[model samples]
Target: MTTTDSTTTSTGSPATAELRVDRLETVLTPTERPVPAGPWTASLVFAWRAILKIKHVPMQLFDVTMFPIMFTVLFTYLFGGAIAGSPREYIQDLLPGILVMTVAMITPYTGMGLNQDIQKGIFDRFRSMPIWGPAALVGALLGDALRYSLAAMITVALGIAIGFRPGGGAVGVLLAVGLLLVFSFSLSWIWTAVGLRMQTPESVMQVSMMILFPLTFASNVFVDPATMPGWVQAFVDVNPITHLTTAARSLAHGIPDTGAIAAVLVASVVLVAVFAPVTMRLYRSER
Candidate 1:
């Protein structure tokens, strides 16, 4: 083992002291290193890393994949008769709402993942590296787009398999899916901020669920909100989830409600605008 040694001495002048150190030396081999990529490139690299993590931890996908299928199938069969006279009729109404709810439900995982990385010191390592500060978060969000897409596809496929046909055709369905993705991406910033603020991943999950459950269930997802009590109906009318579900339902059914689409888009933009800065600030504070 190499070690360093130091010594101190005082001269006759009492105030004068001299210190010397012996430095241990070791030979370092020269190695080629990749240049730092641009912010977008770095973000994409991190995004790829997020995707690759799934290969090692396949269960991470259970929520995105299985939840959609189960929610669609189970709800369609269980309440179809009571709600809409038949499963087929109920699916048309339910699938769109379910799609929105499913993606919304999954957004909290983004925060949970961030909290885990923070706790594991992975985020600290990233902060110390020569990379864009926001790249890690941005990349994770982008990677989550794939998860959202898969969930949406699985839900739609199962719906079709079990007798739900989207009247919106290819274009309408595509539009609805696109809108949902945008909403989910924007909403995730809230969770990311929560993750940064929370002390633990479990706390982040708990807080996110507390907010999401009412937002999803109280809206027009499973039943007609108008049928609820007057006060509850008032809340459902203004709920952002209700607007998103309405927009999705309209587009999926080929009804083309521009108002609902516009509302959802505006809400998404507002969410990103408000939460993104907060999340980034909290992220930097951690360093």
Candidate 2:
């Protein structure tokens, strides 16, 4: 360390004295630094980071890959005959419903992951950086969208292998998937908000699952709502998941259900509008 001598000086009134250092030095290094990244560039970098984590720990994908496949197969084989009289016949309706279910179930992981980041103090570290504030969260959401896409594709492929033939053909399948992705993307925001408000990752997981289970199970994903009790039918009638599943099925059959699709789209937009702001506010105020 450089040494300095301190001298004391008295003002003319002799009431106030100041201490002065002969030489002052600072710790800053003399180095040229590159310009900071733009918001989009910064977000993309964080997104790439999320992707790399998956590459290293491929098992993290089990929810999106294995679980979706498992659900599609198990439901088709075990309950197909009981529900629709034959596995092949049942799969036609079941595939579209199951795709919605799979994505709905998995979207909550976004919140749990956020809670984990906070627990590990990674969230604080990201917050202290000079980059755009929401980049980390935005990047994480984008990465999760990719996982949702993977689950959707795997579910569709497995359905096809087992006897699913969408009357709407490839175009209908693609349309359904596109609609599903938007819904999933919006749904993840709810979990993201919950994650920030919760004390632990487990709390986030538990709460998210609680909300999702009823939404997916109580909806018209399996049997027709008409088969359900009239009271239950009332709930199913307004369930967003029911709308999504019906729209998916309609699109898959080549006859689009404009009302259901519009409902799901409106729900998606509302979810993002409400939960996205809440998530961001929580993110900013998080300790």
Candidate 3:
């Protein structure tokens, strides 16, 4: 004999005896299918989720808060006099360059975070949702804005404390910080692409360090290009980090280097154009 869900037998397993047919139907066949979120709405939701994560694990801001302090303080005191005559003299230049470096360095962590999510099956769940495809990636990037802003603020405030003064004043500093954020946002797209292609978060970090170390150190970040060997100077001149640091230093000091600013902007555009689509493709290909 066949038994329908409506029929119940108290003599059988207790679990089966208490089964409810209506509850099963309600789940298997909902009254209405939920509407999919709009692209902007979905992206924002993921961004908010990122903030909630930070709320629970406050230490997530460790890199954001600590990097600026160490780079600004350590470099300002240790290498300042040797490089630029005194800590004060060096800080005037060091602060701006360090600000750019600090933010740029943290960009790699974006990839690490993405890789972690992928391993934890978080992205799988995200992909299964009926939301915009890029929402999760874009939202994580949007969340990173807070970290970048915090780094900039801490670097600026600490710089001022140590004798670094922005001749351009508050407005100029704000403008410089805004530009750095824009460039950093574009820079992060490169890492997201790396994150998707790499098998593990550690691998992503290794590649990122290899790329970033050369770019930041070989650039005109710490010292004047004129003092470097001709070949190194040649490379530094074309390095995008150099361009960004030069432009940021100019803006913070109130001079505003238009050519450098233009170069940074162009580089930002190129990075996004090249990497953003690749990241999306990789994100989609993942099973």
Candidate 4:
């Protein structure tokens, strides 16, 4: 038989028994290592992550359904007669502008949401992962653009149901949709920059809405530019959304708006040139 002895210590006339202890260290090995990703592949991976996130959070769909109904009802019935001399004519005149407005306003969530993730530390996890550089952020932006496309199409469909018909054939309609997306994507880059730099998501929302509303409404969206006062018309003429709305209207009405298309192209190129580097820099600086 073996006996184990415990050491006792005396403190202030009281004897206390002490148990010996040892500290243990643990090491965990991952089952798999991250694989190297090509640039485009990494972008796609990040884009897919954003899409999956959208699936879990579905409040975004409300905007898709609501905007079309709201605008269609408001402009068609409320101010239609005052603006276009008839409600039906107003619907015809304003549908293209509304389509352009919807696309431009709704798509910024892509960049804004991504920026929120970064500000909230979710992006830190992605940064630590083996995802490709620029993939997580840029891919997320592009993925959100898909939502904008869907929303635009649905809104256009609703317009059709409400007596809005495009004089342009399928190809013209397709071109209009394509141009909306292109411009929206470009605009999103600016929001992406803002979101990346901002400390809170709410700030992003407020700032973005402040900028978007004036841009969308002050243009030829609900009213004709000819009816606008001179100062307002000057502003609208330079506004990128004006070009987009004009281009959409031209395509829908089967009219040639070569100047509007050129304006859209120029504005998109300028926005991309301005915001892309800024967003990327903000992304890297966030590290």
TM-score of every model versus the real structure: 0.88, 0.87, 0.89, 0.85
Instruction: Rank candidates by TM-score, best first.
Output: 3, 1, 2, 4
Show the colliding residue pairs in model 4: none
Give me the runs in candidate 2 sitting further than 4 Å from their true place: 1-30
Top TM-score prediction, candidate number = 3
For candidate 4, give the lDDT.
0.79
TM-score of 1: 0.88
Task: Decide which is better by lDDT, 1 or 3.
Answer: 3
Q: All candidates' lDDT scores?
A: 0.90, 0.89, 0.91, 0.79
lDDT of 1 by residue, 110-190 (tens): 899899999999888888998988899899999888889888998888888999888898788889999999999999999
**Model 2 local distance difference test score:** 0.89
Model 1 whole-model lDDT (C-alpha atoms) = 0.90
* Local accuracy of candidate 4 as per-residue lDDT tens digits, 189-266: 888888887777778878899999999988988877897799999999899898899898888778959999999999
RMSD to the hidden true structure, all candidates = 10.9, 11.8, 7.6, 10.7
Model 3 per-residue lDDT tens digits across residues 127-160:
9988899898888888888889989999999999
Residue 121, model 4: lDDT of 83
Which residue ranges in model 1 land beyond 4 Å of their true spot? 1-35
